[model samples]
Target: MKIAIVVKEHIETKGGLERYAVTLSRGLTARGHEVHVYANRWDVDESLIFHYVPCVKWLNLLKVITFPANARKHLAKSSFDLVYSLTPLYPVDIYRVGEGIHADVLRARFPNPLKRFLKRLTPKHRSILAIEKRLFTKGNYRAIITNSKLVKERLNQVYDVPFQDIEVIYNGYDDKLFNTNTRAYRGNLRDTYGIGDKEKVLLFASNDFKRKGLVYLLEAIAFLNRRDIRVRLMVVGKGKTAQYKRIAERLGILSQVIFAGAVTDIERY
Candidate 1:
């Protein structure tokens, strides 16, 4: 069978979603299915065919709006047994909801009612919401796949997608890189960071610190400090640390938090 995967970017070391796309393509190819990846940017992988979907990069809203339109045009020119999309593209065979509902994300990111309303009015959010509504309400895909039940429930409640149409498949890790063998590096990693044996270490890893609630984690750490608990937070991800550093300082727990910017070998930490 010939399969096409549509995503904005396909880089294994970039992030979880990108890595998933790469892994899926490789797995399908290894199983004797011809796999083609459609993306605006991607690292060269010899095993799979690549099709570039051009999109504007100057503006965020334009980037969101153009990708699906461009990707659909490219997809229409090809014949594939399955069209599996990681990003929002209409009328695919399968649509994987890697990122949760945009509406729910906005609600969480902007707790203030007025701020949330203002954010919803933005062109990017509006365009995303419109696409999501069309995709879910119109049954654009044969089936919807969500990484978590929370997202599946939200899809049902917000877009009225039938429960039977959504399947929950949890995210998987690369066993080759993440298995027990990686545990051998744990002691060295702790030593490199000067983590004492007695100190409890908490790891918070995410590319988007704001959305993932790094501030909340820092607050919890500060609270623990006040109770005379010795804890060290090792943050491992690619996100701006200046604002969060100021936050830690304000909470008087700057010394306890270690911001380890993005590293490829995350499993060792």
Candidate 2:
């Protein structure tokens, strides 16, 4: 089968969605299917074919707005068995909604109904929400692929999408890379970071630190101060950790938590 996979940026990126696209493309290619990745920027890999989509990048929002539009136009000129979009866009045979619905994200980020309403009016939010609504409600998309059951439920709750139309395909991890055998590297890694062998280490890896509840984790550590066991948190990701560091200091766990920003080998944790 000939497949066209559409994503906004490089599949080799550190982001979860980007990594998944790379894995999916490679998996399909290994199965003897022709896979083409369509993106604005991508790491050159001999194993897969990449089609560049030209777009304006003066502003971050402009790139987001132009990528899908230009990508769609480019894909229209090419023929393929299926147009699989990783983004929320129309005229695609299959859509993998990895980010979940914009409405659901907005709802979670802004608990207040008025804030959510106002957020929807913003250009970035409005563009994403419009595309999301169109994809679920009006677009002739053959099937919707969600990364989790929670996302599938959100689709039903937000857009009234039938259960039959949604496919809950969870993300897969590399067992070869991530396994119990990594325990051998644990001591060395801890030593490198000055983490004592006696201390219990908690690993939290997410690009978006705030959304991943880093503050809550720090607070939880503070509450456990009465316990005899020593606990330390190793944060590995890209985010503004200054505020979270202040929170840790206030909680009196500043020395216990270590922010190791964005390590490439995730298995090391």
Candidate 1 segments whose C-alpha is farther than 4 A from its true place: none
Q: Model 2 residue 175 lDDT? A: 89
- State model 2's lDDT: 0.84
Give all candidates' CA lDDT scores. 0.91, 0.84
Where does model 2 exceed 4 Å of error?
A: 226-229
Worst 10 residues of 2 by lDDT: 7-16
lDDT of 1 by residue, 118-203 (tens): 99999999999999888886558899999999999999999888999999999987788878898799788889988887788999
Question: Which numbered prediction scores highest in TM-score against the true structure?
Answer: 1
Q: lDDT tens string, model 2, 1-269?
A: 99999987654547888888888888999999998999887878787889998888887667667888888889988999999988767878999988768887787677799998998898888888777777788456889999889989988998988989999988899888889999999888988999887878899998877556788888888888867556999999889889788988998999999999987787888
TM-score of 2: 0.93
